[model samples]
Target: MIRAATDTGTFVPRIPLGEWVDTAVDWVTATFDPLFDGVKAVFETLYDGLDWALATPPFAVVALVLAALALWVKGWKLGLGTLVGFVVIAGVDQWANAMDTLALVLLATLVALVLGIPLGIWAARDDRVSRVLRPILDFMQTMPAFVYLIPTVVIFLTGPVPGLVATVAFAIAPGVRLTELGIRQVDAEVVEASRAFGATDSRVLRQIQLPLALPTIMAGINQVILLSLSMVVVAGLVGAPGLGAEVVASFQRIDVALGAEAGLSVVLLAIYLDRVSSALAERAPVARALAAAR
Candidate 1:
């Protein structure tokens, strides 16, 4: 018996998605070389400043500062854990690398917050803006992390700067989304009441909407930091120096011990940051309530 057309092999398209993407990237790189350079310079300045601050301090001093911060944010147990974790990283000779990773993560997070929060505010305030940004945010969040590095490398070349740029791009979506969500979730009655009290649009946003939405925004920041940390190892592949670089080097040389140590350092940093940020987010609601009470 003859097989039906439904049993035929799947059809293949002649379109070359890879080639199309490469061409688009090339065009953008050529068109915006100076813009990319300026971005690279800004990123480098921030990264260098943070790295210097972290690296110049005596190891013990740096560890103490981090422990203090943890204590301030999370309480004594996390503070002690952070102190011990940093000491262990230093003992394993990974202190510098860990600091480098921390610098990169923080820098990326700052950039993401700077850009994301504003976009989120815009999106939340305007229906058109929200509709336009939803798909873009979806794309940013769903795309593979490695895909972000491609255009970044083309525009900025391989280095910590490019890695950071890509990281901000990859990690910023949540910030925008959460901020928009938070602002939108603000009570309509509260916003109207503020406006009825002769508050201008900006005043209403600043005093009522943003204040109420702050907790959600803080959660967004927490997510951005976590996502930035997740990109550390992948970013290392493009010459981002830090624990990521160490992890990559270990893999290249088949040194399991080194990889494990570096990996553990990353884990420790992640835990510290996650806990502190989470605690801060938890505090936002209390802070808002106190402000309202006043």
Candidate 2:
């Protein structure tokens, strides 16, 4: 005496959510190990290259150049501050590890911009995507940072790569969300004017909206980099190196002075990166124009 379908078929009950998820993960791991291996290999190659490049004397040379660039783009004060931060990190016997952390952070931030900016543009152009993305960004922003480390560990495995993966995941939402908001907030009249002038969708997006929205997108990038830096210690739990790992080790042993040093290093690094990113974002439109002129 059960409810009957139109056809003579029996219905099966759906699996519980917990069991379904576990089973799906198991299936994916079993079936997609090769795909995962390929991805890991690619990341390893990139990070390994970074490791070699940054572990050399040229890293210090590059730091000096970056300090000069900062002076030109921002101001003498920011340049001096950045130089001081680098010097402090280098002097504290943490140069290699600090560089490793910097490499991972810079790489992750670049990846986020590469992927997130397009998604943001898509969301901005379409009302439906914006509606869907807004809630998701809210979740990414509102969720506790520690909780992000768990799933990241399971997927990427425990190490610097996993930490980088988690840091990117944690930081990416803002860039996407802000980019969407910035583009959408562009003057409707200007967009209409572009359309009236026979601009294609791509032309309007590239020449009109994005140029106008560049500052906002730059702000988003700045925020993303800052957020990635904030997650460094949490990332260290999964084997991310540098001051974060030191912080973790010091805290484990209750070594107050060591922890303080690690913490200060992180703060200094954050300030340096933050200022540089902000300046770059602010300067992008002019730079783009100059590039176009060339």
Candidate 3:
């Protein structure tokens, strides 16, 4: 006699966690239909604007602008590299896709910073909030990036919308965590001094804390950007356009040249973004610089 496939030597209980999550999601979806619709409308408008702006310009003009920006921030070497990179992308006829992907990354990063920085400030201000958020951030950062897409797909269906949503969810943790850390690292004596001089909490934050923490916050911004770019590729699985979609198509067709083209474009964009942001992060503290100007 052989044991049945379902037979177990010892009894064990199974958890219904997934089912519970599904039920919760369904309820939220049903209850928040209008809210989600509003969010989708806003996001669609943002994406369309970015896409149009990026695509409307001549490739050479846009490339020149990017190169100039890079030159301004980091120096002439990065500027030359930026121009060459875009030229290569255009030579491969992947300029449109690269632009689309850049739009998505920018939009995703903006959303993350908008939401995460405020939450980080709140958490830094209150121990209870920090305690509450720590575990949640840990879970977010530790969870498999792909897992974010499932709920987004269920909520928004497959398209750029869900892809963007999933990318933001997957990439937002660092922004929040870093913002909090940067704020907390500010010297308590400085904060006390500001208060002693009749500075309000908000004033202290805007003039003292923010300027000092600019470098750290900028680091968080860089992480958010890179993470958004990484997730853009994953989000391509949901029909998000750009190099990621091209990469996915290459995989489907087993076309090495196509994959290489898209991959190289992505690498160029990443290096450009990383170098420029790193330069920004190393700049003088914002508040002190402003004071010096005065």
Candidate 4:
């Protein structure tokens, strides 16, 4: 008997896309063991230093110092807010976990910025590079955050190291995209005039493009930081210690008070960092060159 053409059986064979990905991951891990170890060491050192700095101090003292930093950056109101926020977090007995989360977030943001800014600059200079990066960035941002943990966990096992690597990958896209946007948004006429007046590409970028782009760049930095905070908290699922641990514990044990306390502490830290970053964006100098050109 002849099979009907309307038969529902799929004609195409199933593609083993997952198996191919697994092979690639296995090969990379085997080949890059030494490189990953060196990277882990560096990240651990930076994390340890931040952890000690924040954790070793009396809660009051660390709070005051951060408040002072806020005062310097934004003014008295934010400084006061920072102080009170930390005190409340400490009151909830979530201070240590909060500090751990902060360190991870800060380190991840720093690394993202360092890598992103230059890449952004390059993309701004070259249309080809920008075109090439668009889809890659779209994939990075659109992929589920949890999927990032899979390769990292496979390669590095569970812990802050894997978490850190995953968090960095998750949080880096905005910095690159924004930096490119900010640089491209710089007034082209101003750039041309500077070039006409004997300014080199480097000089025009340093003195004109970057300064005028400061506000936008700062906005990008703010995003990088906020994303880092959220990702770091998620990282706690892999045995990374922080308020995330506390938050996760609340879910597992069905503890209301613990959830409220940990959740509030995360919110407090997020707001403080956000406020500082937003304030810094507003503070970016209005370049004299752009003003004179206008």
Residue-level lDDT tens digits of model 1 in 160-265:
9989988899999999999999999998998888888899999988878898888889999999999999886689989999999999999999999999999998
lDDT of each: 0.90, 0.82, 0.90, 0.88
Per residue, candidate 2 scores C-alpha lDDT tens digits across 1-294 of: 345454858765554777786678777867887887776677767877886777776656967886898898899998887788888877777777777777788878887888899999999988899899889889988989997887666667877777877888899998998899889878999999999999999999989899888888888999989898888767888888777899899989999988877887888888888888888876887446756789
The parts of candidate 4 lying over 4 Å away from their true place are 1-12, 287-294
Which of candidates 1 and 4 reaches a greater lDDT?
1
lDDT: worst 10-residue window of model 1: 1-10
Per-candidate TM equals 0.93, 0.87, 0.93, 0.93
Task: Give the per-residue lDDT digits (tens) of candidate 3, residues 128-208.
Answer: 999999999999999998899998888888878888999898889999999999899999999999999999999999998
Write model 4 residue lDDT over 124-143, tens digit each, in one string: 99999999988999999999
TM-score of 2: 0.87
Clashing pairs in 4: none
